[model samples]
Target: MRTQVAIIGSGPSGLLLGQLLATVGIETILLDRVSPEYILGRIRAGVLEDGAVRLLDQAGAGARLHAEGLIHDGFSLAFSGQDHRIDLHGLTGGKRVTVYGQTEVTRDLMAGRAQSGALSIYEAEAVTLHDFDRDAPYVTYQKDGQTHRIDCDFIAGCDGFHGVSRKSVPETALRTFEKIYPFGWLGLLAEVAPVSPELIYAHHPRGFALCSMRSMTRSRYYIQCSVDETVDAWSDERFWDELRRRLPAHHAEALRTAPSFEKSIAPLRSFVTEPMRFGRLFLVGDAAHIVPPTGAKGLNLAASDVHYLFEGLREQYRDGSGAGLEAYSAKALARIWKAERFSWWMTSVLHRFPTMGDFDQRMQEAELAYLAQSQAASTALAENYVGLPF
Candidate 1:
């Protein structure tokens, strides 16, 4: 088989890239180690920046999103037993975020891909990249007791951190950076209305808590916990009680509980691999970078990465230019670092550190107070939260 691009994953990044390429007549074949059902089953964050939403629209996947997604003008920061709302719309000059699930975005992209008659092989086994560093690049995989080979002009490593794409790169060729937080988020998803109309980020002596939702009827809640914590230790009642304790009085009073259908503890970490391109292969989304969820930047960052790579591919295929591809890594990393800083800063401000001394605690309080009271500080937070321009 031959294609212009061989995408190594069927996640949103790969699907979005393929959809965008198809808009201009470029052909691609997607390979994934998991089934499509498994892909959609994974729960993830869905806060969409204007730029991300625009990219989805550009890919022709915005119909369901715009029709069903919730729009939030502002969100509250809970501390000192009170709610402080950051006016995202006013601060960012009418920009707002849409509450759409990542799974839905992937589904829309998958539908668009299928409708375009592109190729996607789910449950492909033993996928491997070969000669990506040379002029000729190809991929091999086993399926149904048979071997198949795909020769492509380029390879896209959207398979995520654990996938073979990044691991295929020689260690000496890549520079890595990482920081693992001391805590994790114990999240619960239930079929009930959210405690509040808008998302809330709560800072309390106990830990950090986030109140988010997939829709008006499905609420997602999380509270900070030790890194070693497990889902087995938390029952529905205990999780609800712990969540309530982290919120302010009014929000706690307004909170409603139901039997949770999903529960898990995810560790927080910030990781990045420098120079997202390796010759003919490029890493996208979690394959290149990861951010703690405090700033709600994971999916948005992935969208931005997809945009950069799509532009480069488009330039190469349509404009007969190599400049965009050459500049892709530097451009993507520049925005990536800014987002990393924002996510790191938000995590620092909103989370309780296990090693926080008395002085550190007071400083965190001062920072939150300043962020809530000062217009300048609030503007900065709102701007970053709504996302920076592409």
Candidate 2:
């Protein structure tokens, strides 16, 4: 099969790219390793930054999101037994975040593509990429135990950190950077009510605990643990006991451990690959960069990549130019590095360090205290959290 573009991974990045391209009458083929529904069924990040929501709306992908997604004007930082609220809307003008899951976003993108009768294939594993320097680069993969090849004008590698597209790039052209945290988050979604009105980032003597949500009926929560810890090590009784300690007593229902629908430990890390574009193969989303969930920038950054890439492609097709493609890597990297810095900053400041001395712990407390007391510090945090400017 042949297309103007071949997108690997049907996640939000790939699906959104295909949808954007199709709107411009650009033919695209989207491939993924799992069934579309299966990919959409997984639980992931649920915060949508202002720029991300607008991009979705502009691409005609925000019907369901606008209808069902919750809009939050602010978030609270809880520490020292007091709450400091950052007015996201007030600080960033009208920019507000929406409470929408990544899975839902992917579903909307896929449904939108299907309505247009676009080519999207699931259960397709990319074996390798070839001829990236040529006009017609292609990807080889297997489907239903049968080998297949797809030729395309360009390849967008959105399959994520473990996918084959990254490896296809010559090692000499790659410069990798990463920082793995000593702790991971044990996140869970329960059938209980939310403890706070909006998301809460709390720093306690025990560790860092976050209060978030999936919907009105389902509450999402996270607790910091050792990177090697397993969910099995945390029993229901233990989970509730720790929750009671970390969460304020004002939290409803004595914090019973509701039946957990989803449980996973995501190790905290910051990762990036220089020059996101390599010839005709362009990497986006997790395939190119990763951010700790602290700032909720992962999905938003991926959406930004697709937005820029689509813009660049239009320029290339318009004036018969190569400048846009040449500049794609640097442009995308600028935003990627900014988000990476914010995520790293938030993670380092909010999370408790195990090796902290008295002075170090005092410094962390002082920083939190300053943010809680000063409007300037609060606004800085609010701007970064609400979403960096496009």
Candidate 3:
């Protein structure tokens, strides 16, 4: 098979890139290691930044999102028995975030791609990327116990953290920066109503508790846990008890519990690979970077990468120049670093640091108190929460 671009993942990043490139008469074939239903079964991010929503709409992939996605104008920070609401829409001049899972986004994009009659190879595992230095690069893969080769003008690595794309780059051409947190998130989804109208980030004596949702009938919550905590260590009763201890009980009457549909743990970390490009092979989304989900920046950051990458490609071909690819590293890094800083800051504020001394903890509490009482501090958080411009 031959195409203009070969995208090595069928997740939102790769799917969205194919949709965007198709607008400019560029054809792409997306290869994924898993089936669409399996990919959609993995529960991930739930917040959609304003810019990300706009891009989806522009690509004609936001109809279901706009209809069913919940919009929130603000979120509350609860600490020391106080609730401080940061008006995101007010701070950002009407820009707000939407509550939509990454899984749903994948489903939507896949449907759109199928409707457009685009070429996508599901359940194809990318084996290697060859000849990326030449004008036409080729990617070899195995599907259904058979090997196939795909030739393309360029290659995009949109696979996750464990994929082969990052390793495909020569070690001498790679530079990496990363930080792993001492704690991870124990995420739970139950068939119950949400406890609050908007999301809440609570800091309590026990640990951090987050109140979020997937829909009006389903509640999604998270609590800070040791990075090594196993899911088998907790029962349904213990999970509820921990949630009650850390989460505010103001709406206890409204909160209901049903059998869990999904439960999992995610480690907290920040990662970024420099340059993000090497000749005809480029890395996008989790393949090039990762951030703790505290700031809900993962999916949006990935969308930002694909958008800029495609814009660069268009400029390259349209103007008969290579300047866009040359500048891809600096431009994408600027946004990536800002998001990394924000995610780190939010994670530190909510989670208990194992290495924190008494003085450091006290200072952190003092800062939280100030943020609740001071307008300037709250505005700063509001700005970051609503998202800084890409």
Best by lDDT: 1
Candidate 3 lDDT: 0.86
> Which regions in candidate 2 have their CA more than 4 angstroms from the true location?
252-257
Cα-based TM-score, every candidate: 0.99, 0.96, 0.97
Q: Each prediction's Cα lDDT score?
A: 0.94, 0.85, 0.86
Error of 2 at 146 (Å): 2.8
Query: If ranked by TM-score, best first, what sequence of candidates would result?
Result: 1, 3, 2
lDDT for 78 (candidate 1)? 94
Clash list (residue pairs), candidate 1:
none
RMSD per model, one decimal? 0.7, 1.5, 1.4
- Expressed as tens digits, the lDDT of each residue in 271-295 for candidate 2 is 9999899889999999999999999
RMSD from true fold, candidate 3: 1.4
lDDT (tens digit, per residue) of candidate 1 on 178-237: 999999999999999999999999999999999999999999999999998889999999
State the lDDT of candidate 3 residue by residue for 312-379, as single tens digits: 88887788787887777778889999999999998888878888777877877988898888888888
Residue-pair clashes, model 2: 0
Distance from true position, residue 368, model 3, in Å?
1.0
Q: Cα deviation of 75 in candidate 2 (Å)?
A: 0.5
Models ranked on lDDT: 1, 3, 2
- TM-score of candidate 2 relative to the true fold: 0.96
